[model samples]
Target chain A: TQLLEQSPQFLSIQEGENLTVYCNSSSVFSSLQWYRQEPGEGPVLLVTVVTGGEVKKLKRLTFQFGDARKDSSLHITAAQPGDTGLYLCAGASEAAGNKLTFGGGTRVLVKP
Target chain B: EPEVTQTPSHQVTQMGQEVILRCVPISNHLYFYWYRQILGQKVEFLVSFYNNEISEKSEIFDDQFSVERPDGSNFTLKIRSTKLEDSAMYFCASSRDSGLQAFFGQGTRLTVV
Candidate 1:
């Protein structure tokens, strides 16, 4: 079974603090996507990394895919209260028919 | 901006009863998928549909569960017999093609009593 594990299942930080969430897997992926979900809502796509070692930035959020395409990370710089939510990492692999295999989510709480 | 939409934000059904969850994927998308998330658990892929047939499915998608695109626009998932374990947040998603970004619906929360 292909499994993606995320670290720091829960994070609590004050506003203006920075945090990073990591997703790792033993199997290589064709693409990795980051999503943020609010309570009672479906996940909202934040970014997708297709190439190994690729890096993409969205405002204060920075996402990176590992060189082997088996790991990824999300770094939030100077996070604000609005950044508080459940962040999830999902991977798509050709071996898995390109279906997304999701990792356990990281719940972030940024308090003002 | 286009988005996937699901009907009946919440549904409550008794065990052994049947339930149908509906979804309207983004108008232009060609690939449709179903996923579920048990409380406090990771989101898991259930099935993928394309060109009027199932392309892939997980073990969790047993014969008891089925999907259909009855019309060109609406996709539906049917559970022949629901069990207490079937209660979860069911999300519908779609993508323009394979390996692309898949947009998701708000999701239908199914509660099996």
Candidate 2:
């Protein structure tokens, strides 16, 4: 079984504060996706990193895939109240039939 | 922007009753999946469907759970004899190919009493 453990299960930061969430696993994955889900809604894809050591930016969010493909991170610069949501990292392994293994989400609360 | 759509935003059923959750994936998507997020828990993969058959399933997908693509456009999940543990937010998603970006529906909140 593949598992992705996310750190800082909950984060409370003031507006303009920087935050980073990490997702790590023991198994290598073919791709890693970052999603943000608001209350009572489905997750929205923020970014997908397919190549090892790849980094993608979306506005103020920066997503990076580890060189070994076994870890990933999401960094938020100058977080705002609008950024508050559940941040999730999902890993997809081809050997696992393209099934996604999601990490425990990081519930971020950016207080304005 | 095309998106996955689900029917019945919320469903309330009693334990031991049956329930069917429906979804319409993106028109061009070939891979479909069902995932559930139990209150306060991580999103868990229930099953993955491709080529008109189940490609993968987790332990949570037991005999009581089944999936079907009754038509070319609609995919459904049926839970026979629902349990309280089944109460969760069920999300339907689809991707053009394996390991690709998946578009998700708003989700159906199932409440089994």
Candidate 3:
């Protein structure tokens, strides 16, 4: 089984602060996706990183796929109160039969 | 914008009772998936359906669990006998294909009493 280890299970930051969440795995993946979810709701897809060493920016949120495709990271800059939510990373590998192994998730709270 | 829709936003069932969760994926999407998340836990993939059949399933999807695309637009997950551990938020999702981003429904909170 391909296990994903996430960092800093919980994070509390003041508004305008910056933070990063990491998703690491030893197995290579065809694609990696980042999602954000609020309480009592399903996850909403934030971004999908496919190619190695690729970086995509969605306004204040930046996502990067590692050079080996075994890892990814999400960076939020100048975080705002609206950024508070549970962030998740999912890796999809062909060997895993197109299955998604989600990380434990990071709970972020942006205090204003 | 279109989103996946699930029925019975919340369900409470007695232990050992059968239950079926329903979903209507985005109108044009082709691949369908069922996932569950225990409170405060990560989303777990249950099964994936396409072409009127199942394409993949997780270890959690055992014999007691089955998926059916009943018709042209709806996909359902049937649990023959729900256990207490089955209490969780069940989410239905769909993507144009594996290569696309999957959109998820609001989810059905299943509380087994």
Q: Between prediction 1 and prediction 2, which has the larger TM-score?
A: 1
Per-residue lDDT of A5 in model 3: 79
lDDT per model vs. reference: 0.95, 0.95, 0.91
Worst 10 residues of 1 chain A by lDDT: A37-46
lDDT of 1 by residue, A1-112 (tens): 8999999899999999999999999999999999999887899998989999999999999999999999999999999999989999999998999899999999999999
User: What residue pairs are clashing in model 3?
Assistant: none
| CAPRI-style class, candidate 3 | medium
Deviation from native of the Cα of residue A106 in model 1, angstroms:
0.6
Q: Model 1: residues >4 Å from true position, as ranges? A: none
- Write out the backbone clash pairs for model 2: none
Q: Rank the candidates by DockQ, best first.
A: 2, 1, 3
Overall local distance difference test of candidate 3? 0.91
What is the per-residue lDDT of model 2 for residues B29-84, given as tens digits with 9 covering 90 to 100?
99999999998888999999999999999999999999999999999999999999
Instruction: Rank the models by lDDT, top first.
Output: 1, 2, 3
Error of 2 at A108 (Å): 1.0
True contacts kept of each: 0.66, 0.78, 0.56
Cα lDDT for residue B99, model 3?
39
